[model samples]
Target: MMIKWFMLLFTGFAGGLAVGCGFVAFLSVLGIIPRLMQLTKTIKWIRLYEWAVILGAVSGGWFSLSPVYLHASHYWFIPIGLLYGIFVGMLAAALTEVLNVFPILAKRIGIDDKIVMLMMAIVLGKICGSLFHWLYFAGL
Candidate 1:
């Protein structure tokens, strides 16, 4: 039980960090922020975004696995949960971009780009998290 919780926590955190950083990097590549600012100053509010992503992933994973976890071996559900989390994150980012509903901080930073890259990162993160969960279940 404790191990499962720890795995979930770590998976969520790592997934969040990876996706958040990847998205920021993608924006930078598109010249969203000035080069000087991108290289020199640490982005403000990035930590907040990371935490948000982590929490969102964890919650999504937990909720998705609730039924399976309760009835069967909780371990088997980990991978599926993680995969579901990745899909949720990706979908959420894509929908937000489509609707132009990103947090105000994103606009404040002037991160103008294709917007599709952000969506891709989110989806990829969720996939990675799910894969990780699968690996854990396989004891790899």
Candidate 2:
């Protein structure tokens, strides 16, 4: 029984580490952090950015597996939500830029001349969707 429990725990730890490494590798391959740093002109804070990513990943995993809750007021959610939106927006931008997705999509859709408009539409749609979600689902 003891050996079985030890093996199970070890396996779980190994699996989690593997997944975490893969996630980090994926972000690195996507050049998300570097792109963000370049755009923000914070190349000197590279270590800080790296540490933030590592800590965020670990904290996210821990929070997901643990039954921890924050007792913050609804007002605090505004900044939190904004930060989440910024991170998601940056990640999406990085991925699209890295893969040249926008150009390819524009060419394929015969909207090469209106690529800027297409991008603006996507941005506006995302903003509207977020607003709707916050207003309807979150009641905020």
Candidate 3:
């Protein structure tokens, strides 16, 4: 039982980290956020805000997977988790824009025409991370 729990936790953490990093890298490549905030003083705060958003996304995704991971045995759960992450990420971005919320994040990250692209990257990362556990079970 203890091993099972550990496995679950490990899976969750790995998924979160993978998704977060991938999403951030994709955003940088797309020029949605500055490519070199590491070198810029004014945009330094944006890096912090970006981290917060990615962390929040990872947490949200992990929570979303908890029930399925605990109860389901099907490998399709992996793809489902990925799809869920993508859906949630896109929804979060859209809702934030439509509601005019997340102004702090927007201001810090430097808004561009590529918001949709960035959102897609975030969603894809989330899904890919969750898919790992799904594939693990499939091997079993």
Candidate 4:
């Protein structure tokens, strides 16, 4: 029994570490942080950005997996939701930028001249979907 519990704990820790390392490696290979810094002209704040990413991942993981909950007011969720949206948007933008996905997609689809419109539509769709999800699900 003791050995079984130890093995379970070790396996869980090792699996988590492997997944975490792969996630960080993916972001690094995609050059998301560096590209973001370059685009924003905030290269000097690279360390700050790196630390923010690390802290955010750690705190987010803890908050998500732990049974503890903060009984914050509904108003507090506004800023939290905004931050989540910004993070997701940045990640999606980084992925698209790294792969030149939008341009290639537009050219392939013969919408080269309407690339901006395509992007705007995607953004609007994301916003509307997110809003609908929260509004509809919150009632449940």
Candidate 5:
């Protein structure tokens, strides 16, 4: 139980940081930011965002899997993780279509950035994954 709270807070913070950094870098690269900045010449922010993304995903993966670690046999977590991956993918795809905000924002910004979609997908996946794990344990 203590470990669960720790993982929750850790992943939440890590994911939030990544999402925030990604949002800023995304806006800059997507041409949404005002032309005055011209920040693309220096891709240091992009590097920071990329590393944040990798860090967040890894940390959140550990955080997200804490439940399975607690309840499952040593080998069960492996298959469960694979199943969760599939579920996250499907949830992400459906969410992107339903939200519609990304496309409109991108259209307004005047550039089609695929990375924008990728970032949104990651966030949606994490949220949906948390719910899925909750439901799984609740049902058992």
Candidate 6:
């Protein structure tokens, strides 16, 4: 095999974590997360929030797969890719929530969210990377 599974797994996790943290930090700095969290307070804007997540996931899925992306002449590819994107976005949101919610843990653990984010990213990346690797190896 030209690829090592463990390396890919490690790299995926690290890369994902970095990207996730950076994305969250970027959102937080923009005050978007607070605004987003506040959407739960009222009945309004929740739909907007949901739509944002869906859109984010869809966009994420599209970009990530775009690299080695096959030409999708089939109509199903778009919808299917969107579903995968939704999955990615949800997973990413969950990771962001965990780190943002807990500050004391980082102090106590003497580590940072960077590491935590990295771990989370690794998991998300690993899952997705596995799929990618399989596709690449299988000549899909």
The alpha-carbon root-mean-square deviation between model 4 and the true structure, to one decimal in Å, is 1.5
Give all TM-scores, in the order shown: 0.30, 0.88, 0.31, 0.92, 0.29, 0.34
Superposed Cα deviation of residue 4, candidate 2 (Å): 4.7
* lDDT string, candidate 1, 17-112, tens digits: 897788666545544333323443546756764586568756766787586545677676768766767555544554454445654435666665
- Sorting all predicted structures by TM-score, with the top scorer first, yields 4, 2, 6, 3, 1, 5
Give the per-residue lDDT digits (tens) of candidate 2, residues 1-140.
99999999999999998997889788887887888788778999989998998799889988998999899998999999999999899888877887899999999999999999999999999999999999899865
Candidate 3 TM-score over all chains jointly: 0.31
Best by TM-score: 4
lDDT of candidate 6 over 11-46, digit per residue (tens): 988987787787767665655545445533644766
lDDT of candidate 6 at residue 51, scale 0 to 100? 82
CA error at residue 73 for candidate 4, angstroms: 0.8
Q: Give the lDDT ranking, best first.
A: 2, 4, 6, 3, 5, 1
Off by over 4 Å in 6: 1-3, 33-43, 66-140
Per-residue alpha-carbon lDDT of model 5 for 21-87, expressed as tens digits? 8866754454432321232344546666557556766777678768654665857866886687755
Model 2 lowest lDDT segment of ten: 31-40
After aligning candidate 4 to the native by TM-score, how far in Å is the CA of 82 from where it should be?
Answer: 1.0
1 or 6, which is superior by lDDT? 6
Instruction: Give me candidate 6's TM-score against the actual structure.
Output: 0.34
The runs of at least 3 residues in candidate 2 whose Cα sits more than 4 Å from the true structure, single-residue gaps closed, are none
How close is each model in CA RMSD to the real structure? 14.9, 1.7, 14.4, 1.5, 15.9, 16.0
lDDT of every model, 2 decimals:
0.62, 0.89, 0.63, 0.89, 0.62, 0.64
